[model samples]
Target: MSAIPQERRLVTAVPGPKSQELQSRRTASVAGGVGSVLPVFAAKADGGIVEDVDGNRFIDFGSGIAVTTVGASAEAVVRRASAQLADFTHTCFMVTPYEGYVAVAEALAELTPGDHAKKSALFNSGAEAVENAVKIARSYTKRQAVVVFDHGYHGRTNLTMALTSKNMPYKHGFGPFAPEVYRVPVAYGYRWPTGPDNCGPEAAEQAIDHIAKQIGAENVAAIIIEPVLGEGGFIEPAKGFLPAIAQYAKDNGIVFVADEIQSGFCRTGQWFACEDEGIVPDLITTAKGIAGGLPLSAVTGRAEIMDAAHGGGLGGTYGGNPVACAGALGAIETMKELDLNARAKRIEAVMKPRLAAMQEKFEAIGDVRGRGAMLAVELVKDRTTKEPDPQATAKVAKACHEAGLLVLTTGTYSNVVRFLPPLVIGEDLLNDGLDVLEEAFAAL
Candidate 1:
């Protein structure tokens, strides 16, 4: 059905002459701060394959960092977005509101967790949505302090950088970040100090205690966390952790915000990862996989909290662009039509076992974890010590790229090789990508 061939094909060496030429051009034009995972320039992409300028077709395991759940060139997305584009490009949602924007808001209200009356406001990126969510929470609760977890990545913006834990690339040199942001411990099972068994209750109690004593829970506006930590090595917080935190927020009148940017919209075997624990957030920020590669993010939450912000308080010039809204609607349609949640579960079923088997053979693999297509393997220098092996992570990623499999490396320690294959990726292609990974590990 798709025009682009699904099979991987390598007509030339990875990053061949053409891509090398492009790289030279990019170096001259693009900013040095902007980094790319791979140097292979894409000529075409569809399903699970990205054909490069040099005729090397690589299996896409990163899904453009979990943005394309329904594939890059999904038919419904193209059709609806093209039709909307032909009709009108932009009037700006604020000046002249359109049905597409409202339609998308309606869809988000119905899809996101919670049966309560909900409302949504759209934005250009996840950072904008998160920033806006914080604004709304502050306005509603009349509080200033916000709580975030360690190893949780909200975005690149100043406030989000302060909320984020990583210091090297994210927060390095980006000084004088926004004030009133508090950091707390996340129930990271693999690296929890007291061990995984007590991680949930112990970490939650410590985090709550610190917030109550240090920041004064009464002054806290919000407690934001990723349901499944993304750039932090796909770490799923230990069981009972989220619920405990949510309850604490509720009791303290603090807004419980779930940053579902990378884990929402069927990428995590459910509509939202927060649903896995039946934890209902006061506000949920979503972006990455919402619009089939188009830039669109939203802050969906309780109607009362959302309405706390004045009419003119929330919105940007390009927020909720019609074309992006159409893409989102199309993406939602594709998800329901294709049953992508089930597909994500199936991906997990296939990937986790293989990763576990790899761990059995390879002592360097400290942990294999993640839900659905959002999976990862944390590399370590020694299994006993669990010391991060960022060098091995880099080596394995480079090997995968050379073999025409696109994978991504992440984590606070930079020792996590994360897999975020498109939900539409065929099983054969998925296995091929994993095969490339196994070979990389073996060679390492």
Candidate 2:
């Protein structure tokens, strides 16, 4: 059915001659700050395979950072997007409203957690969605301070950088970040000072106390968090942690915003990870996987809160582009038709046990965490110390790349090897990628 074969086939070494040539050109023209996990330049991608410029096809474990849940070139996505491209590319939603934009908003309302009347505003990226969510929350509450947790990565923008806890590449040189952003401890189960059982209640109590004491609860606008922390080692908050936090926010009138950018759209075995704990956020930000591969993000929330912003207060020139909206419609269609949420669960069923086995064999594997297709392995120097082994993590990722399996590494400590295969990926390809990972760990 697909043009590209769903198998791993390496015609040349990773980053072959053609890719090398492109890399040279990229270096000369592109900004140095723009980094890439893999050096190979992709020419064609379908299903779970990314065929590079040199004709080497690598099994895609990283779904372009979880943006292509249905696959790179899904049938519905291509068909709808192609049809929309021929019809009309852009008119700008703010200038001239489109049916596709409204359709996407309606879909999000039905899909995202909560039965209450919901509304949505589209943007071009996760960062923009998050920024706008913050704007809406502040407007609704008439508050200034916004609370975030440690290891939470909202985005790369100035305001998000301040909200983010990590300081390395994200916030290193980007100083003088926006004010009124406060950081609190997250219930990272692996690194929790107390045992995992107590992590949920203890961390929530501490976080709430900090907000109340350090920053008055009345002054706080939003308590935003990732249902499952992405770019922070795929950390899922301890059980009961999210519920407690959400309840606190509800009681205090603080807007609970779920940043479901990476974990939304069946990537975590559900439509959104927040559904796992039954936490109904006041405002939820979505992107990355919303529009197949096109750039589209949205802030979906209770209608009352969303309407807090004045007329023409929220919008961008390129937000909700017609083509991207079409892709989103197609992607959502494919998800339902194919039952991608079940597929994500199946992926987890296949990956978790294997990763657990690897953990038993490899001492470097500190922990294996994450949900459904969004899984990761945290590498450490020693089991007792749990000192992050970023060097070993790098080696494992390199080995996977060399073996024709595309994987990604993420974490605040840079010691997490994350796997985000397309939900449409075949079981054979998934097993083969895991085989490559096992071999990589064995070699290490």
TM-score of 2: 0.99
lDDT of each: 0.94, 0.95
For model 2, what is the error of residue 279's alpha carbon versus the real structure, in angstroms, after optimal superposition?
0.7
Flag regions of model 1 displaced more than 4 Å: none
lDDT string, candidate 1, 1-444, tens digits: 766888877888878999999999999999999999998899888999898888889999988999988999899999999999999989998898999999999999999888999999999999999999999999999999999998999989998888888998998998999999999999999998888999999999999999999999999999999999998889999999999999999998999999999999999899999999998999999998999999999999999999999879999999999999999999999999999999999999999999999999999999999999999999999987899999999999999999999999999999999999999999999898889999999999
| Candidate 2 lDDT over residue span 1-444, tens digit each | 768998899888888999999999999999999999999999999999999999999999999999999999999999999999999999999998989999999999999999999999999999999999999999999998999999999999999999888898899998899999999999999999777889998999999999999999999999999999998889999999999999989999999999999999999999999999898899999999999999999999999999999999999999999999999999999999999999999999999999999999999999999999999999999999899999999999999999999999999999999999999999999999999999999999
Candidate 2 stretches with Cα past 4 Å from truth are: none
Question: Relative to the unseen true structure, what is the C-alpha lDDT of residue 402 in candidate 2, on a scale of 0 to 100?
Answer: 96
Error of 1 at 49 (Å): 0.7
Best by lDDT: 2
List clashing residue pairs in candidate 2: none
